[model samples]
Target: MKMRNLPPLNALKMFEAVARNSSFSLAAEELCITHSAVSHQIKLLESWMGVKLLQRHSHGATLTPAGQILFTTCVQLFNSLENCINDIQQKPINHGITLGAPSSFMANWLISRIESFEEKYPEIQIKLMTSNDFKLLENEQIDLQILSLNRQVQLKSDLVKIHLFKDKIGPVLSSEKAHNITQPSDLLTQTLLHTESNKNAWSFWATQHQVKLNEAKNQRYFDHLNLMLEAAANGLGIAIAPEILVEKQILNGQLIAPFGFTDSDAEFTLCLKQNCLKNSNLQTFIEWIQYQVSID
Candidate 1:
């Protein structure tokens, strides 16, 4: 058997940091090292590789073609190493699977239904992580991710995507404020709430309904959809949200969807690595979640 020759591990670590951040100074700060030390390590790496890895500019640095290739490999290697460490550290505990999803979905949809899964699979523990970063999947930080995507968009080849449910969105407001929004035009007279992540959701709905938002005078923006929905329930304004998320609020008489929901091109999807289903526990979760969505 032949041993593989590798670059200096420390130098590779510094190079990865610099490439990921696109700034030597920021990487140095994150690594708690001097800027000059970071530069030295990068130079050492470049000397060994005999290639110009980075193109420096006044603003920051950009990776060369070779650098990009190396960076990609390094990211995959590091994530695998981290996951291995985590699995070893948590082996004494119950078998755990980390699930990541958007904050709004986690709070409004999954949280209420997760207890059923936990009760059914007592030996398998679920760890909830809320993040909109899809890159986390590639980083191996989460075993599975729940994402909302337009049906037209395509994912990478190595990822496996499962259809969860159709996404239907509509304008929702407090019961007291619903009366004022009898028609689409009536929205112009009310303050429209928007989520920063999906700033164009209202526009998309308006276009589909043949309603114009150009004359809408008052509007507010929230960082999260859950916060925007809470504002609507509190009578702050009318917010456009997915029906699945606002079902409980509407059922509780806190919100009213006078216009009713319209089917959108987007749908909730479950994304995981191609090989993830090999794990029985994870496979069980996939089956259970698919069943849940099917019944819903």
Candidate 2:
């Protein structure tokens, strides 16, 4: 770091540009200086180092053994400096954030709100993967997850968990299909659509209403809430849906909630490996989610 022992940085930069391009004119063009200025800096660098770095030819220039060594070192040094600057500036140096969640939540909830998040943080690119498997985070395949968990579920203690909100369950049907039913028991005559992931949703709603459901009817089952809600909107049958995921559909008249919603023991939670909490991109996304919840 002693300034007296080092050659001038401007001279070193000029020499590097000349050596890289093998032409003083090209280096001067890149540095926005006259060709004579580039030649003068190169002479200054050689005088300071007491070694001839470039062997000038009639057509161009070539690096001597000493010059080649210096050029290689300069390339690495400049590249490292650029990387440090990028990290300090919070500029993107690699692929952006990656998140994982269940298929239903990804399709029904997060997909709808992602555009606003993108608009707010245009510099950060977000990739969403749908999988029920939590192992992806352990393998470093995903940075974080939006997990839906029942109260009885247990997770590793080291993982950071943030509770966004609890989910509520209710019957959702199309407007035309919902008009026939005046009471809860009237659902006995209609075919019911079921989501395999939330098999207990209807039972929770029925318990809240103090009504028994007729289970003998043939019920159609879907693996995710997105498909079940879509089926209900198409008048396939009345589906036991989560209020949080289907709120927009109900508001748009795509689906109707005949009976009011009831709280379920399940919660919608944000999960990430403890170390990922320090990542700025993930932090921004988590703060956005918190902001959304506050407004709701």
Candidate 3:
């Protein structure tokens, strides 16, 4: 994996930017160059290789079959170089730690508490990514990840997982709507709000409370948890949400949980690769997370 025979650095970077973003104009903006300059670089590369690498459409540039092959090779090249640099460094790879978290977790927990982590480790930069699917750790170059383990998750890697905290969830409603939900059976009388995006939520909560859901009675559904919370805040209906995400709202009296319903529910975990589990930089992150969980 010697870099001695590689193509020009500028060309490789331009190719990657366009490939990753799929637009010459976007690549130009990212590289601080003009769109025509990006096109010129691609043209030179195409002439050298004697192939049409990209299919330019009105919307964006898509990789031609040849471009797809080249892009795949470049991604490997970058990953290998990253691994090599990490292995060569004598210290705990501190400059950057790439992270992946659930969108629900990001919107609720991580974003709010991020300033503290940054203040403590200002020298160690972080790149945050979000996905509801926690399985991104299997193939991605993620240093750490967080996920809700309410259900059995399918993943493809051998990982060292640390359980962070269990989510205590119950129905949240506006003060006005709270009147209709006197008991579990009264849930049927109200305008049931839900997140159809999370397939297991409603059914699982129903099973936990020993109640059946008349799906037909559901009045509103949203894809994102934050949106559902907003709807409930506006007196839309009762929303079943984790206490961790809505703690600020609950504390401020914007919402209410009239019935306490956390009855031996499933949990979420904050996990990392075991080999680097004791890395000083990552250890700082782990300690901070554990402190929050402990106090809660």
Which of the predicted structures, 1 or 3, would earn the higher TM-score when compared with the native?
1
Highest lDDT scorer: 1
Clashes of 3: 0
TM-score of each: 0.69, 0.65, 0.64
Q: Which stretches of candidate 1 lie over 4 Å from their true place?
A: 1-94
Q: Pick the TM-score winner.
A: 1
Instruction: Give the clash count for model 1.
Output: 0
* Residue-level lDDT for 279 in candidate 2: 87
Model 2, residue 235: distance off in Å is: 2.1
What's the distance in Å from true for residue 17, model 1?
Answer: 36
Minimal lDDT window, size 10, model 3: 149-158
Q: Lowest-scoring 10 consecutive residues by lDDT in candidate 1?
A: 64-73
In candidate 3, which residue ranges exceed 4 Å CA deviation? Answer: 1-94, 151-157
Candidate 2, residues 1-296, lDDT tens digits: the string is 86577799999899878876778888999999999999999999999999889889888786654675576456546655655798999897665777777756654566557768988888987666655667977777678877778877777876878899888888889999987988887776677888887787777777777767765255788865766776788888889977887887888799888877878888888888887788888999999988887787
**Over the full model, what C-alpha lDDT does candidate 2 score relative to the true structure?**
0.78
Q: For residue 30, give model 1's deviation from the true position in Å.
A: 37
